[model samples]
Target chain A: MGIPYFPGCTLHVKAKGLDDSTRATLAALGLELTELPEWTCCGTAFPLAQDNYMGMVASARILAKAAKEGDGRLVTVCSFCYNVLKRVNFALKNNDEARTKLNAYLEENYNGELRVLHPLELLRDDLGFDSLKTRVDRKLKGMKVACYYGCMLSRPAKEMEFGEPENPALMEEFVKAVGAEPVDFPYKTKCCGSYQVLNNYDLVAGRVKDILKAARVRDSEVIITSCPLCQFNLDWLQDRFADEDKSFSKIPVLYFTQLLGIALEISVAKLGLDNHYVDPKPLLQAG
Target chain B: MTSEEMTRKVKELSGQNPYLCMQCGLCSASCTGIGVMDLLPRQVMRFLQLGKEEILKNRSIWMCTTCLICTARCPRGIDIARVMEALRTINLRKGNDILAPEDVPAELLAEIPQMALTSGFRKLSA
Candidate 1:
């Protein structure tokens, strides 16, 4: 599958492992990821919620650049980027007033049809999951992981839907392909309270607590997720939440691709597992 | 608010069945961060139903994490998260100062660059 890779804001920084492991895994499957040089943020949840025009302009700006780079399809690691970019692009295509306004705002008339794809979508639709199954060097066995989709991947247009929205099988399939047992957890597509971290720490803390509590009760060794915000809320905030509630545990929250890379026997150091707030070693070793 | 207008508005906001809400408190009960909220998830829906634009514009909407727990727990299959997004849209447009102008608040901004340098989330939005 051919597409320019947009790791967005989070994967390059906090969830760098996701980008690294994804690139490696895709390479194993014979796919190339060309990151957009000087790509901007998707303008995240705020632009769309506040101003559709701004959201369209922000996404189109990125697409216009990608168009200039001569890549029509963009692959994103973050669910937020995938959702926002795709929705904005969809708006640009369907709404002439939107297109005109956004084009005017961007100072470039973008007629380019750019398809925003999630990395998992490319893996499943373009590369084929069966091929991924063949590349598994180490199968994660008996390790129950909660496949957290958060908000970005499956919502709006189901931009990267390889499975059900309420009950997803895409991430689960990948987990199983790597040999780990995907647990039936309640909070898979649930929000990590991604955008709320800025205003409501207490609420974010509660959401994290619930996610971890669900994982713990389900006997999950680790939690696997796709979005950077989800990773942040679920992983880094665990300690603070635990301190707040005493009962919360630092359940190693991992970027989903890291687990796949490890199971694929890809180098862990390069995967950036060390960067996570909750160390995944205990869970990885235990499994 | 007219019933038709309310229905259209809710559909525009959440893309779910507003009428589906059984008014069962499961959503509010299961809300992880309901205590910090001025109007709970269920209340958000009720306000939408009643066309309480002011309540929809309140700072509480911005406080929501868009955690679908409330929506998931809703007996009527009402998507409270989408409603939260709708309310967030309204709050943001009305310039309700929930957090700082930046998605990351000012107090957190000092640590953001350092955290970004080490953690990587800062670069995500940059």
Candidate 2:
């Protein structure tokens, strides 16, 4: 049986590599991700205002549709989708007034039973880290990867409830299972200026500079993240920051799934590993 | 809006009692966007408590990424991010959008993830 999956907009477009790698990684672990036949965007931002039911519509619809389809769980790849979907589910489950308004607006009886999950959480809970190690055909023995959690997967602990929300070890443990060294950095859970990147480029570049410096000083070879926004900011902005200052070192940012795909003996080309801005191929070969 | 009206409106929208803040400054100290915000998270909380309408005009409201670092670290358990969102809501509901879709560059539109565009629209628009 295939598990229902919701691939948000970015996964099908700019973050296709993450989507592809996630599918391959899960498949290698003996689970197939079945995409929802009719899924929409999770509105990206979970309306922070208590009354913004319009913002909750998209995510509530997703939760309702998934539950009505006879599945209590729906998994998505990107951290943005996971955050919105998860928070919306939490909000609807807790707030009776908002749930009623949203249900009436969408004209769907969403009981808020559907659970939202990211692939990392799924892998950890479903297949133990040791089980993951057993499936690794190729071990990343000499590689040192920095697991960048960023702000999405680690924020609003009362709402997101993902990982430690501070010193998340899920990605770190996953790195160990893949036979790689996990470098710890304080900036791992820091915000990368997120949506501000589209407007405040210099501000985001400054953030990227700090994150890269912290990780590099710790001797991390490659930085891995589950969010495409973080991957893009670190990967694309690092190149720009490096060009402006010769002393600035560039680091390749890879999706966690891409790293998992490598350990699963999936081809880099098939994972679209070459599509990164910093060119992760050299480090893969080095490891 | 009257001072009391503003206070009530924010309380209604955010569902957070701004007065719970002890002015410990942990929220401001831990804020990720402190470098860009005109008023720190703690200051925003204080302003919210005072029902100061001027807080709505500040850049601090726009700069908040809703990262919730402040919320996670607040000693008083005050959800500062929600307060910031309430201030943003007050401003945005006035039809004065912080970010217009046309203002976004084509280069960014082409390269950035759609999530960026969607979040920007959701947060910065009315």
Candidate 3:
């Protein structure tokens, strides 16, 4: 009846739309997302330094608690959190030294027994796409959607283990199940300039520019993504500098959950479609 | 750290061996940040192999988003992204913060997601 969910920091702050839509859509699917009690940030970006055992503590704390909770599995929507948590889980499971050091530091014994699931994996593995197609009342019949994986969903392929790191089909498969057409673009697995958005705004915008154009070229009305950062860069940067480029038209980028809410007949208001910088409401309504 | 120590430190920090690279240039080709990088990913590996520390000053290491595209494409099974992180860790641990939190404009920080700020500081700050 319930699944322990980790929304991470972004979902609580600026990316409420992703959180709201995820909760709303999952509720519609007959699953309750119970936020784990006393969950803190997953320490975004898995610390790469072997000596940075301190960096692993935050996520380790979360996983240790999730292990004792209702279901032994923990799910998070933030791409960074998913990658970090999953990588930490993988690291803790494989390396005895890391597990011993981290567990000693955290004062808990967690041998990476935690199962972290992204909603996409849940839909494919648990919900079953065939059943999802049958449950849809407001099927998104004619809309062409381009799903952007944008790095975190599947990368360092051995660790994340969700989909193909290159040319991932999970998001596209979800689109097809909802009766919408999924358009494949080259930049689907590409990085959206990530943390560099802070240091070089233009460089980050330039990357987003390419991503938007690639999706638009494929004739996708909107691009959907799982990462909040990816959604922010791809969606907001276009509106931030729209006037600067007269030749390029603005396109909407949205969280995949928002589209899921739509396909499942969750109200547009509840889906947080209006919160986006490049509004997909007009396109969704028209379609 | 000296040029000799840089290679050893990177191996110690990243747990990835740069010496295994065959100069395929696949990492550079696979990098999404190659557009802005002064030193290509392949060149970073080459510099490490040559025991050259000039890679520390290159803007490419900072520009790298650490998406791991190159790590996946490496024929030698090198975690090139970890190598990039190690290069950054060297500078950051020395208190050479590339992105100062104080310099970020108030408007953008107010608008940017908390994860962005957290990850930015984690990687860019000491």
Query: Which candidate leads the pack in lDDT?
Result: 3
Chain B TM (all candidates): 0.69, 0.95, 0.94
RMSD of each: 5.1, 1.4, 1.3
| Better candidate by DockQ, 2 or 3 | 3
Q: Can you rank all candidates by lDDT, best first?
A: 3, 2, 1
* Candidates ranked by TM-score: 3, 2, 1
Global fold similarity of model 2 (TM-score): 0.97
lDDT of 3 by residue, B2-120 (tens): 98898899999999988999999999987878888888899999999999988888888888888889988899999998998898999998888788889798988888989999998
Superposed model 3: Cα runs more than 4 Å off: none
Which residue pairs in candidate 1 collide? Answer: A9-B124, A10-B124, A13-B120, A14-B120, A140-A179, A193-B65
How do the residues B1-126 of candidate 2 rate in per-residue lDDT, one tens digit apiece? 988999999998998998898898988887767787788888877887777888778987887778888888877877788888988898888986688888888877888888988997788877
Error of 1 at A155 (Å): 1.4
Residues A198-224, model 2: lDDT tens digits: 666666877888899999999888999
Candidates 2 and 3: which is better by lDDT? 3
Write down the worst ten-residue block by lDDT for model 3 chain A: A278-287
Interface root mean square deviation per prediction: 6.3, 1.0, 0.9
Candidate 3 lDDT, A39-148, residue by residue in tens: 89999999888888889989989998999886788888889999999999988899898899999988999999989999988888888999899987555787888889
* Model 1 Cα lDDT, one tens digit per residue, B1-126: 455554575577556766677677788886656768787777777776766656655655656554456655566766677776655554444554444345665655542312122222211222
